[model samples]
Target: MNTRPLLEVEDLRVSFPGTTGEVEAVRGIGFSLGREKLGLVGESGSGKTMTGRAILGLVPPPGRVTARRLAFEGRDILGLDAAGLRRLRGARIAMVLQDPKYALNPVMTVGRQIAEAHRAHGRASGREAERKALELLSAVRLRDPERVARAYPHQLSGGMGQRVMIAMMLAPEPALLIADEPTSALDVTVRTQVLAILDELVTARGMGLLFISHDLNLVASFCDRVMVMYAGRILETCRADALSQAQHPYTRGLLASLPRLDRPAETLPVLARDPRWLDDARADA
Candidate 1:
């Protein structure tokens, strides 16, 4: 197994100016990723998404992002200008948002969008780009590539729309993919199907996958390693398969709060928080 680091992050932080004070969305956190699945699990506002956005240079205005180091393929991305960020985004690093309805263009046909993305990222164009679009659609495990490709965003089901988004992202053949709650909106069956496709793609393409989700169990099952995030900081990181053995109080609280079928409980316990975890720079569990 090639365990070389494909992406590196150090002392990453994101701040937004507030009326009262500066609000830190992502406190100083650090980690590295290779050609493997890394899951980030946290509450809605726990900085999981913020970390991804800062790394990609997608943080909106009034949102200040700083890091000691953020590099991909040994290249520092923090200094990338708008054009540099544009060139870096889809061609080298890609992000798959949870909702395809907002991610996909409602007016454009799916095939056109995918083909254009391919052409923009690479030198392929016209017939070649169109062919690559179909190929990508099929690669994403979507059936009837021709019919589906011709359909518009609103014409497809939620699952199909998400699949199309994945297909479009794959057009660039990105080395690192940030999948933020990619299957959260799908039904259980469709969720499984999409996850399977992602697993296959990651293994086949030898790319790094940064999976951000709130589903602790799902992340445990899917990813090789996991990072638990809280109030702008990573609470703990452990092998995904060994999440049940996590030592941090926050991670333990999270696991204890989940209802289990095998060991059923009358009520899930509320997670107890400690303020000290947020301030401790040495708290990497």
Candidate 2:
């Protein structure tokens, strides 16, 4: 078995210039990833999304990103030039954003977009790209992929659009995928199906997945490992199966707030916060 990590981040931090001073969006968080599904769970503004963006060097301008060591396959990603980072983005590491309606092109056909993605990576010719696109559409379990490919993005349902996003991201067969809430917009029933498709593809390809979401219940069940974030830092890291036994007060508070179907509570508890969780960054659980 290959023991080396696919990606390793050490002391990663992102901050933006504010009126008062620098606002730390991601505060010195670090982790390593192999070919496994890892979930980052936290409430909004907890810096989960910013952490994902930083990996791909997608942190917007005016915001600065710094790390002690941001290496992918043992090479320093932080040192890569624009050209090198561009090559790595879709070809080696891809991101599937929350909504396809915003991510996909408004003018391009879904087939053209997929083909373009493949061609951008120098993976195939126009003809072969289109063929591959059709194949991927089917792989995502889209019905009548030929017809769907010819259609525009607006024509597809929310679920179908997300599948299209997945198909596009998978076109390059990247080593790692950063999915930032790819299913939040879909319906409850469709959410399961989309997750099933994503899970199946990621497992078959042996790709590392960094799934970022706010739903603790979904992350507990869907991911192999889970990291609980609060105020720009990971407070706990534990096996998804063992989330119920997580020792951190923040993790426990999150679990307690969830509505249990097995034993329904009269009222869901509100999360009580502590100031020390932000000040002290424990190494790990």
Per-residue C-alpha lDDT of model 2 across residues 8-58, encoded as one tens digit per residue = 988899999999999999999888888888999999999999999999999
User: What value of lDDT does candidate 2 attain over all alpha carbons?
Assistant: 0.91
Ten-residue segment with the worst summed lDDT in candidate 1? 276-285
Where does candidate 2 have its weakest 10-residue lDDT segment?
A: 276-285
Show model 1 residue runs off by greater than 4 Å: 1-3, 281-285
Give per-model TM-scores: 0.97, 0.97
lDDT of 2 at 111: 98
lDDT of 1 by residue, 1-285 (tens): 556588888989999999999999998999999888999999999999999998899999989999998998888999888899999999989999999999999999999999999999899858999999999899888889999999999999999999999999989999999999999999999999899888987888898999999999999999999999888888788899999998888888988998898888888899878888777443443
The residue-level lDDT of candidate 1 at 255 comes to 88
